[model samples]
Target: MTPGTRIEHDAFGPVEVPAERYWGAQTQRALAVFTIGTEYFPPCLLHAFGLQKMAAARANLRCGALDAERADAIERAAAELSRGRFDADFPLTIWQTGSGTQTNMNANEVVANRANELLGQPRGGKSPVHPNDHVNASQSSNDSFPTVMHIAATLEIQQRLLPALAVLRDSLADRTQAFRGVVKIARTHLMDAVPMTVDQAFDAFTRQVDLGMERVAGTLPRLRVLPQGGTAAGTGLNAPPGFDTAFCEELSRLTATAFVPNPSKFEGMGVHDALVEASGALNTLASSLIKMANDLRLLGSGPRCGLGELRIPDDGLTSSIMPGKRNPTIAEVLVQAGLQVMGNHVTVTMANASGNFELNVAKPLLIHNLLQSIRVLADAVRVFALRLVAGLELNHERLAANVENALLAVTVLNPVLGYDRVAAIVREALASNRGPREAAVSLGLISAEDYDRHVDAAAMAAPHGLSALRQEPSGTSGRG
Candidate 1:
């Protein structure tokens, strides 16, 4: 071995590792074999693995399997790792293996070497702190990796994505209440059909995100159940009696999140159904965000030529050649992000589907995509809310003009005056290029008095009962 490097031996034989690195032969071997991507498992996943190792150490000690001094050193090392220290020690890639055994061993080696260092021993020495027999105790990469996936995913949703979505919901709710009285034209099949308060449009988006939040919440129950105890294959071969229970208890104490062992270790090891369900919820959130962004883009289409009911935020970047063309850059970025999230959901689902019996070989892919979706979706929702939603302006003048000038605005009279009569008025309004009231007056479809009574745009935006329709307006001249 070189003066600054050391040789560590595993089942495969000897490997050279850096003198200062806390990782040993397994991690060094993985580094040499997998050069597929630049993306390593993020620090959160590494932190989760650290937490798992610490929990395992405590569980082993509780079961009288690990001596006090050795357990303390391993626990301290793992505790530091869980807090995200020494993340660089885990250099395995997501594409290394579908089962993520390489990263799992990377964690084991790092903790073991760190524990050895704490005991005043050199790194990679298998003496008092053996990676497998001591640090790993009764756990296997199969069980540990999936457990970390569940823990990491649960924390991400609770700490990042859900809170971000709540902020977005608040922004939309504020917009809805603020625009309650602003009437705007509503369309069906992309054709103007009637008038509706701008508030209703915003309300729909609010409800969509609310339901998405509920969908995201639904995933927690399944995610809370983990496969931490099932060693190599669901058999818990080397795990001590009640070890799984103790591990969960220690994990709950450390994380403050209730994590329970799965009753059916077989199912947990054989499939990632919980992750798939959670991905589906994330997919729903993405779809909701896309719809919301598209709606905003449509509303903020143009200041002079298009819908123009709402003005988009001026991002200070115009077309290089379009002179004064502003763009809905925030909304556009959100929609694209949502699309990537949707596609990531499909990747998770596809990976889950390829699961085989006793051990899911596709676990790494499932978690890689799941974590990515959470991060991307959280950022997208936050940016959309702060940049686009908060900056939106209600173009009241343009909105009122569109509502007042449209012929379909007369359709609200369908229940009051009957469809045939309303249709005749709309036809004349469209043919003459005049407002519905003017068309009614010019066509003599109904007296000017009745036209004024039924053409209340605000009332039409939110229609009422037939009693009001039957009650004739004072000084009515249309009954004749």
Candidate 2:
């Protein structure tokens, strides 16, 4: 026998497992076979496995599939696992089986060994509580893994992602209200076009975040529909009748989240459309974050040479060569995170599409990508809001400078001077490198007093002189 290991038997043969660990033969086999990646399933998914195992044990007990003694032991062990007590025992990597069967067996073995220890038996013997027959009663890896995926993802979105998004949205909303009267030059095609309030820009960002929350929330109903009763295949071969409903009820009670059995176990087991839909929503949210982050970076680009319309908060990260230069580190982090979420969505979509007849063979990769996307996005959004958006300061001098220098503000005088006259004044101003007022006065098109009175930059930002502009001939539309 190996000095630091003990012998544990499965259908293959006696296998050597670490003496101090609780996992048995199948887990040890998985550890040796799947040496591909350093990534393991996240703690959330592990906790979800625990919760599902516990709920399944209780449902089995209610259905007369397991005796009270074994069921109680499993429930206790699984509840501990749910609370992260046996985290070390779950050592399988996410790269193991496509069905995540090895991880499921890993959980079963851990729960069984721990339950046996609670019953005053040795850990590796699988006595008094066999890993498969007792600990995993009325369940199969096929059904259990997907159930855990749904549970973990739903909890993550509800507890982490949604709250972070709400906080970000609220922060932007506060900015919108705070800067309502602050006007700045608005650009289209990277050229100054007209004037717009800072609040209007912030309002658009806030609405994007708000709509992202709604989009994510819209996918929850599909996630709550689980396929726990489909064991081995979608035939409910080993699971008891009503086990799906009973398990969902128990799981809902334990998690305080509503869950229901899928109307068709075959469909649920065969495809991951719910997860795909959820990922699509997350992708949409990531796109919005990308746009917001890019806008913030541009708006806060420079204090000396760039836009400089808004001042980004100092994140304590400076450029290596540029002394005393503060970069938009937080916005950059958010943008990178959003980009990663987009890439992970692509992986998830491909993984979900790999489902074969009665089971999707890409279960582990799908859940792993989805969970990673959720975790990174939640963290980035929260930090971006708290560290950057809340501390953003407007550069009033810069806003005024940009607004006063913008030639598009001359469009407001179109109704008074006519298009050709305004066009001539704009061309003269640009050609002479002088202000539009000077150009108009020199061109004898208007006096400086009349130009100032007609060209109200801030008033042009909203509906001003709309009636006069619309009073043109019925067939003639005003030109900018």
Candidate 3:
């Protein structure tokens, strides 16, 4: 079939597709039916598929299934695909295909046909370099799918997600230092409780993100172990004796990733615990992101009506009906993405648990959901930190006003005035609509200047203030 020539096909019913279309009739049909949504198969998984084909070709060569020339052809083709050569051919349409067989065949055919072209053979011609025998030797769809999934996830984490998380961590660190001098009223149950610096709040957020990144890093070692040797079942029945380790070694060398062989073939083929654990790590990160994003939203709530401790940038009009209204749209998107990632984690967990002895048939959905989660989280973390958290401004005046109205002022007055006196003054101040400083002065418990000097917001924002507060006896000197 030459360019601009239409060939009548039995399967496709004479509809004209592109002359260079690599996928077959079934994939084209599925593509037409599943075009209802914008959700397309991500490119990361395709790259992983290409890597898997390359590894399979190496495994075949080591196992004597193909000569060096044929292996070189398949490898060269796979490398081209991995370098993002044949992207347009891999149109995203496997969503409607139940078993993902269409996608598997699509990958096989594309790489094989390309290999044939490179070897100066006719397209789709099975010769010394056959798609199944040379390209897919010693592998089943069951093993190949999950292997590629692991490769995709590991690459995404290392190349994109972890780096984005590091950016977020550094942003929070900078904000922590920037807000170190600003004192704000801390809240519990949405009511004022204690005094803390904005730096402390940002530090807490940074800690959550740091711990989540650590957890993600911890899962990488386990995820690097692959089950390539388990051909169809847990038994390496068709695999050459030493092909397992050699193939893995070759893959590691080719991809520059630590691709190790699975120690126990049974567990590798039977379950997807590695993927489950990876998803769990992602779930941990999602949980942290939800908490941090929600806190940011609440802290930056309103300039006039809410806490107003921090100011987030207003990106757009929040409402169509209301005038001069802005909302935390970035935070909302981060929170929603976190929720979706959590749901994806749950789906992965259930799918992992439901796998039978020899295979986990839920890999298509698992890879789909997991990769989506990773991409959303990586992009969200980057956008949220750069656009919202990094650019946030502390509303120092509002914070001071809230602190003056808070009952926690008694905490500062308890050292100079006894605890009982401070408690009484707090009650009287609340009842008489007077500030704590005024109540202390009216009762002659402390001079107004002395009260101001002792409870200095700037001094109290320091780490030394927390140390001093910790040393003071509980009921004796609540003042630091």
Candidate 4:
């Protein structure tokens, strides 16, 4: 009777469950344990569960396991749940209870109970619509849980993560174009090695991100294979002959995403290799993101103390004690997010290895952690693109000054003055604490006008000169 108190169920017969156990007692226990500091629940998983229920109800209707009226009632309830209703009912504490049976039961009970209420029946009444008998009929926790996971993961990758990555990739490409005419010293092993355009650096970042997104995209087709008809042990013992294909087809139609019946129901139901593969792709993308974010942070480190190629926007106070100090907080957040995704990959890996032949007990944690990675990556990409990448300002004056001081500037004059003589000039410039222009003038190896014409930073930074150098014959002398 009381909100948080358990009430007796008549169908399962006199079983007293907590009133707050709307999703059942197991879910209530989980809600208390995995109480991490996340503000929002993973929408992808929620949407997947709702979509699965709708698909399953349709399948049951077609099979005559559920009446048309009840099927319609379940569909309406599922739609409402997908639209953000009954979220509180899906709450579960985050702890490994040997398997994800608790979580699956939570979805079953919530959807079933809600559907019953929508059909003008009492909370636990199964008269017109039964939760387990009709709604979850022909389904086991093993099949349903992983099916939902696969659905959720695929949708999230296609709809959320991929789009965010595209936005970030485009932003990086724009930076590459904008910096095409700006030359900077290319550092190898933290020492200047050659002259390169700032555009080249941004292009490298864009390429890694684009490749990472490709890897992520490549994993989606594999992720669409569902373990639905496998039932308990991948034998389809309880499920009808046509249930697997029909259910998958219905799911595909309902979610508007590809959902194929897995080739090996045993493997699909018992092992989580698909999840491991997907997580691996996410980890790869996250690593690329970390590298890019780190580079941006270092490049924009300080106006006076470090390589100040670009400046980040000041959003909030970076510290409590330091004034006028705006830190690369956005970059820092992106780094942290990438780290979280890597950790999630590790979790999925461990879970995948721990599974046995009949069922993987790690479904709940696997889905939870994988979904966490997807959400974090999607948000991080968006934030970095809009707040950090798009707003980045190049300090042209500083860039030019740094390029002028770099000894690698001798690279351009190597064509006119020869490598041996240019190498001598570079050494002299570094030793005398003077710029290459001043050193060249004092050394008398070059006229002031000749040096200016051959080694101007602006000229060297252009794509034409760089393209020519790239096209040059390796063994040939650098003469016009």
Candidate 5:
């Protein structure tokens, strides 16, 4: 053996594992060959692996597949692993195996070794608690890895993503109430269209975020269906009868989350359609977030030269060359994060579709991208809510100015002056560089009193007498 390495034997031959590391022969071999990427599985996934191992051990003990003493040692070691005690022992990157077999084995070996150490045995000695026979009892990398994927995804979405989104939604709802009376010019096709309150725009964003929460929640049912007892190509070949249901029940008790055995373990291991469906939901959310972020960028465009409808919260971020230049840094960051999530959706979609007969060869990549999407998007949303939406201010002066000068408010005058007459008024207003009211007054179109009575910009934002005017036959339809 090498100076600092200890000999561990697998089916292939003797291998030298680092003496200080708890991983065994297979992990050492994987570390040597799969030198590819820097992207390791997230801590949440590792924690999920430990949880799965612990649950499996409990089930195996109940099924009489493991002795009570070994099971006790495994439960202790795995519980510690789940709490992040053995994080350093799991160093394999996501690029190693498609089914995450290497990572699964890595977890097994670590738990076994740790359990042995706790039972007065040396590390790397598979005695009293063989990694596969005990720690991985009634499980295969195929079923267990996918189950871990589901557990990790569900926990992250439930515990992290939804709460962060709710924070943003509540902030937006508060803004909605705050801006209810502040009317502004609305735009369509990048042109001034009519009047709308600032609260209306904020309310629309609140609805989008609410629906995003709903969409993310919609994916949980499918994710909670676990494929754990389908050992070796979804056959349940080596797993004891009733192991699937018992394992899920134990996992649910451990995590306080509802999980059930998949009805068809073959489909669960073979296709990964549930993950694809989840990616679709996330893609929709990304699109909504992008829309909201870009709108913030546009609405808060400039204090002098651009729209200037909304004022962004200044966080001390400024351009290097331009003094006193406060950019919409939070909006920009949010948009970039949303774009990355959208891109991750594409990778997930393709990876899911590439699955072959018995198992998808894209498990590691799919979970990596999905979990990354959840993490970054959740953090960005929290930042957006705290640093941007919570501190957002309306540019009241600009909003009033734009609403006062809006030409499309003349649509409210259509019943008083027919569409053709109103069209001429619009053209004349533009040609003569005059306000619509002024243009109508110059043309002897109507008395200024009537113009003021009919053209209240704030009232035009909601239902007024316009519909009644259009319906009443006694309406003034004059061209003279």
Candidate 6:
């Protein structure tokens, strides 16, 4: 211990704490007990904690339970924490007590110590702003931690993840419109199928993002309900009357997000099912992103011997061994991000299931994994939009050539000609290394003039009425 450090005592006994630190006994104990990973909650969550403390102080003051001076000191201290000035003070790991009681106490101690300082008291002096009596007035770890969980998760989604997804969606929509006329071969089961515009492919990707955004939006209503008033066991015990309503009102005002007291506070405390449901939505988004990124990688596979359809910018990254070789850096980045989020949902679901009795013990890990997925996904989506998807280049000549040489282009003739005849033509085109149109002509299945009109890539791409080369060859009536 440092020479200037002071010893603080709690139920467990005395422990030496650094003199410059704002946290007290409980926080110091937790810091020493959980010497696990360095993965702490982000600043946003800590800010949410500070904001919750501030709202509680205001609510307690408004309800006449707390005096003005103590409330003002706690409120000022909370505002500073909410502004993220004390993020370093919270060095506790994510792998802590299941109910996150230790972290809750960490917040309580920081707020109390800082509040005392605001009143000209020495650091660690919990006089006017007692950690539990004032800073954590009218609340418990069971209630306050869950309340901040919802608030932090909600804001992170609305302000960070959704906007990043919107940018990616817009980028895809732009490409869809820009490439509307560029026709390319469609692939099914990794085999050539038919002709479709490049825009059609991008349009599908845009719809995936749209649906992902909607799924995430669906979780907001449930998240807006808070369990802050139901301290200890959802009974609102020891809390002043009307405190719940006031706390919610003050919280809503402070966050600009409407929050109501949970009618069934027991359910909120007993099960983190709401978070599990939100994780499901995030998982769906990760799946969609992986599919889209994989598609981009396939499209941008090769500028020489592969698809050669789309070009992926390598973000200035080049292969060390093979100079001038650019990999699909952003696509790989999104794929790995998706994998992590997919894994995170499982952890959240399992943790939610492990909650016993009145309080779920998995609170710390739940919020940790949830915020981890959101922040990583948001950053990856933004990078994909601006650095990769928005700058994608199309190989128009390659696309046109692939569409021309497509053997399955004859599949369109199946509607007019019999399937057997079209199959024969497909085989002959592949074997003879001739275009489908030329095969159809040489096989005497259609006249050159009629083949020219019917088998055109663009014409077959969107056919209004069924018509074949040579108008259903004489004596060979269509199956339909």
- lDDT tens digits, residues 319-400, model 3? 8898888899998999998999999999888877767767776777777888888999999999998988888888878887
- Each model's lDDT comes to 0.86, 0.90, 0.77, 0.79, 0.90, 0.89
In model 3, which residue pairs have backbone atoms overlapping below 3 Å?
Answer: none
Worst 10-residue lDDT window, candidate 3? 5-14
Off by over 4 Å in 4: 1-6, 10-13, 18-21, 25-41, 413-421, 441-450, 456-480
Ranking by TM-score: 5, 6, 2, 1, 4, 3
TM-score, one value per model: 0.95, 0.95, 0.87, 0.89, 0.97, 0.96
Query: Count of backbone clashes for each model?
Result: 0, 0, 0, 8, 0, 1
Clash pairs (backbone) in predicted model 4: 5-19, 6-17, 6-18, 30-92, 30-93, 31-92, 31-93, 34-94
The number of residue pairs in model 3 that clash at the backbone is 0
Per-residue C-alpha lDDT of model 4 across residues 1-480, encoded as one tens digit per residue: 555566535333444456643464445555666675453346667767788888888888887777898888888888776676777676654454545666666776777777777777655555576667766777888888889889888988998999999999999999889877677877888787566788889999999989989999999888999989888788887676788888989988877887899989888888888889999999999988998899889889886899888887776766778877889988999999999999999999998887876888877778888989998999989999998998887888888777868888778776666788788788888899888888888987877876666666666655655425533345443443
lDDT by residue for model 1 (1-480), tens: 778899898998988899889899988888888988877677888888888999999999999889999999999999999998898777777888778989888888999998998999988887789998898889898898899999999999999999999989999999998888888888889888677889999999999989999999899989989898899899899998999899999999988989899998888888999999999998888888898899899888877788888987888889989998899988888899889889999999999888787888988888988998898889889988888887778998998788778788676566555678777888888788878898877877677786677677787767552325644454443332
Instruction: For candidate 4, give the lDDT of residue 105.
Output: 66
Task: Tell how far residue 165 is off in model 2, in angstroms.
Answer: 0.5
- The C-alpha local distance difference test score for the whole of candidate 1 amounts to 0.86
Which scores greater on TM-score, model 3 or model 5?
5
Model 1 worst lDDT window (10 residues): 471-480
Clashing pairs in 2: none
Error of 2 at 223 (Å): 0.7
The candidate with the higher TM-score, 2 or 5, is 5
Q: Is candidate 1 or candidate 3 better by lDDT?
A: 1
lDDT of 3: 0.77
The worst-scoring run of ten residues by lDDT in candidate 5 lies at 464-473
Which is better, 1 or 4, measured by TM-score?
1
